[model samples]
Target: MASKPGILTEWPWTRLGSFKYVVLAPWAIHSTYSYLVKDTTQRDLSNFLIFPMLLSRVLHNQIWISVSRYRTAKGNNRIVDKSIEFEQVDRETNWDDQIILSGLLFYLASMYLENGSHLPLWRTDAVIWTILLHTAVIHPFAEHIAYFALFSIPMLSTVFMKNISIISMAGYLTYIDLMNNMGHCNFEHIPKWLFSTFPPLKYLMYTPSYHSLHHTQFRTNYSLFMPFYDYVYGTMDKSSDSLYENSLTRKEEVPDVVHLTHLTTPESIYHLRIGFAHLASEPHKSKWYLWLMWPVTLWSMMVTWIYGRTFTAERNVFKHLKLQTWAIPKYNIQYYMKWQTESINRMIEGAILAASDKGVKVLSLGLLNQEEGLNSSGELFLRKHPQLKVKLVDGSSLAVAIVLNSIPKTSQVVLRGKLSKIACSIALALCQGGVKVYTMREDEHKKLKAMVSNEAGHNLILSQYGTPKIWLVGDGLSEDEQKKAPKGTLFIPFSKFPPKKDRKDCLYNSTPAMLTPKHLENVDSCENWLPRRVMSAWRIAGILHAMEEWNMHECGNMMFGIEKIWKASLENGFRPLTTSVDPKPN
Candidate 1:
């Protein structure tokens, strides 16, 4: 809300007509770009002009207004009208459109810069450095802020489809030209080529794919330069179907700060739960001290808000951050699966109990260690009942192992696919022996959902034995991770879990779940426990001596740092590596 005099509030179209006053863009940019490619006599001035215009627009009121709207919505002014129904649109367009715009803008701006002509060695070097710094530091930060502001408005589109052809066409053409200019013909680092490749692309602008999802689904996809934007802002801002369609409509009012909600689809909720857990693990001040740290708190909050808002405002900011250029080669989904599974084991039984309405069989994969079962005691109780059957699989293949262990003593099995296929081979062998076919994995639930929409019959093929239901049987794993389990699988996450018994269930069952040599060491080693006291004595002596040296100069607030160090020493279980005061000669 800017209250400009003579503004047309009721008639939107009357205000839109004001765009006619905008001067036509200069023709020199196109001429320069065309002339550079076709004629050597023409100076390469495309980048020098284009980049400035884009930057200028960023400084303009329209962009700032968009940024303010985003901040207001994300901050204290956000309103949620649950009655507003919107169709599912691809939010991914936010990323796609941003990259396209940045590419055009960057080239135009670069042309106007001094880099357009060859000069003396030192002068040329200075110009190149200037361009690099401008492209990297100034451009990425500014773009990230602006784009965040623009995308913060969570408006769902009437059309559910994406303009992929436009995106793909623009992406390939622009990226190829960009890659060529960066001095590399391919996607690798080589000499001067290394700087110009993917990293620069990501540093300069986001890829089209990233923003397209934002447009398609407005609420969840707010980040500009990095996916880290949402994490920093305390919002689970990522691409999701619910945010694009049903999320805002179902909720009656928008929150000042995004509230933790169980119904925020599966992915967003998982991020919140797991992220909060991680935050809890980190060292933080007591509630009272934290509340007292008003300046620091305000600074942190403002930074998050500004960072998130910038990305939403400037769609091309993602490209400027070099998100598209850098390749995360080893982003394995399976690695995450294994990690989550292990963490879940700490409270598996409880998760199972939470998920099941009646006693049910649990076919645990690998080893169902005692601690894991104990952590998930509710599931354990259900297992003890006569109606429930608990199975354990100890096979090489994870999928095969979990299934084999879960099957009841006697059950019929069906087999499909060729004999050579792993699923088929295991199914046939197990079927002959009257064992039911089953699939197992951390993502079993997600697979089941995808199975629903797949018209190719592949989904039905996987679901022949039915989707595996997951009672997390543990508190550590996130709801999203649980949901991602095979489709038709049920998630028994601790938070927002269905009620059981009269007492409320604990969100985290942190009852000394893991027992190993580490736990034994904790109990047996007096030396480990004594180190904190020894360290505290040393720290106190050191501070006393330092204060004396400074003649009481360090007395005010200086002791706080030492106090923090002392507390950290105790919390981390610090200990001396050697038993002796001094090492003996070897």
Candidate 2:
């Protein structure tokens, strides 16, 4: 070993730390020994001495780098810089490359050596297995030793066991390479020992056919060591499955040595089917196991059903969901019963239809749960008239009076609490610009009407039966109570209201009544068998008519109250409008 002058030269690390240099001394000594052994005439001593160490080092580098990168990539769900390099360089360090290079060097040197006739062996399999044994024993343990020398063993215990099998296999293949490849050799003719061992050795190394496949078309042809294992395990790809019928090139092929390059749906499903087959083929079949596993099977079935319906069925599920209730009109008794059961919905339907007929662009508001309304009643209305532009805003946004105050600037609808301020502000702004303001609401019709009191205000009208606070502050009122109100009060009825028992103070009048067309008509007439408040009566009638036409009973009566207030002011010679003191700025 010391006869090599280059190897015996002073170490590069002599100027560095003693402890670190001491560690590298063994490596220097080993390198010298490897150099000497390469030229040694004794094949057994050379192969036994150098091949194991070199193979182990190569495998150590490969497995450590591969697994380190795998862990790093898996942690972040992405491959970082070092991981990418590791993945690229991992398969390139096999025995064949090094062996070919070394063989060429040795062959060149042999021309000048004593009694050198020719090379012994050049087969790639012989080179690989020799390297394999080196890799198996040396790589993993060397990696652990190297890392531990630098860091601590406890820190790398996780990595120690990750690639042990690959290392062991490499060691086994390396031993086979020694016994078979270097053990028997002839330059010009087949060796007698090789013929004796060739059949059994076929199980241990790449065969002639496999070696050809690896060299020429390695992308799809990879069956290392034992081709049968590759076949049985379904790793070998014959490339029979074609993505394109006319192409024989295995159109989308992954590199033979690397498994990560290509991914296909059929390949994935094939693997899944293989897994399922394996599960089904279990030897110890038990009914109890099947019974316990039924829930998982059922869940998988449901998932598959959903997935199939989503992709394979080629239908828009959302659209289907929306139109489910409006099923193809059935001309049967069942259809008639459905129509009868949905009579109330039919009224809203009629209103929508009428709005369409009258050329009014109708849109539904206040319905937040689209699945509930749109899938049923609303969907029918929409499909019958597809041009309608309906929208669903969050109901919770308008739930409370205070929450209504903080509404984003984009909100257009006037919240219950902000109504008075918004009405006053709009009226004030528009009146200044010579634009008339017509503010409307439920019970606070009177208060909104009072906003018209501004001199510059063109025509401000609030059309509800009660005060601003009463409309929001109280629970709610009934149809009769709204109509029998005093002069300024207009009966603005709602489709439904909380019962009087629930909100007693919200009741607008002494008499009890429900919301019906007949009751609304009486409210429109404004003839409650009492002395005539002439302007109040006409204003109430006008309010009632508007509400009936627009379907805003509460809103109409509130406007009636405003009209009464305005007319009263006109009769008294146009008094300056006085608005109620609004609460603190929201």
Winner by TM-score: 1
TM-score of each: 0.19, 0.15
Clashes of each: 101, 22
Q: All candidates' lDDT scores? A: 0.28, 0.29
Q: Give me the displacement of residue 503 in model 1, in angstroms.
A: 47
Error of 2 at 242 (Å): 90
Q: What is the lDDT of residue 334 in candidate 1?
A: 19
Q: What lDDT does candidate 1 reach at residue 422?
A: 23
lDDT of 1 by residue, 1-586 (tens): 3477344323222333323212223443464566567655554443333444443433332233333323322322222211110111111113223433444443443345333222112333333333332222111223434643333111001001111122222233343334222221111112233434645443334333333444445564355434444444544434432332332233221211110001111121111111222212222213333344467445544553234111111000111110000001111131235553444433333333322332222222111222222223123444354343322211113223222333334343222221211233234445445344343332433443243333322222234233333222322343433333343332221211121222122221111111111111101101111221121122122222222222221110122233343333233333322212211111
Report the C-alpha lDDT of model 2 over 38-103, residue by residue, as the tens digit: 656643232232334444544444343333322222222111111112122222323233332333
lDDT of 1 at 584: 17
- Candidate 1: segments with Cα more than 4 A from true spot: 1-78, 81-92, 112-377, 380-586
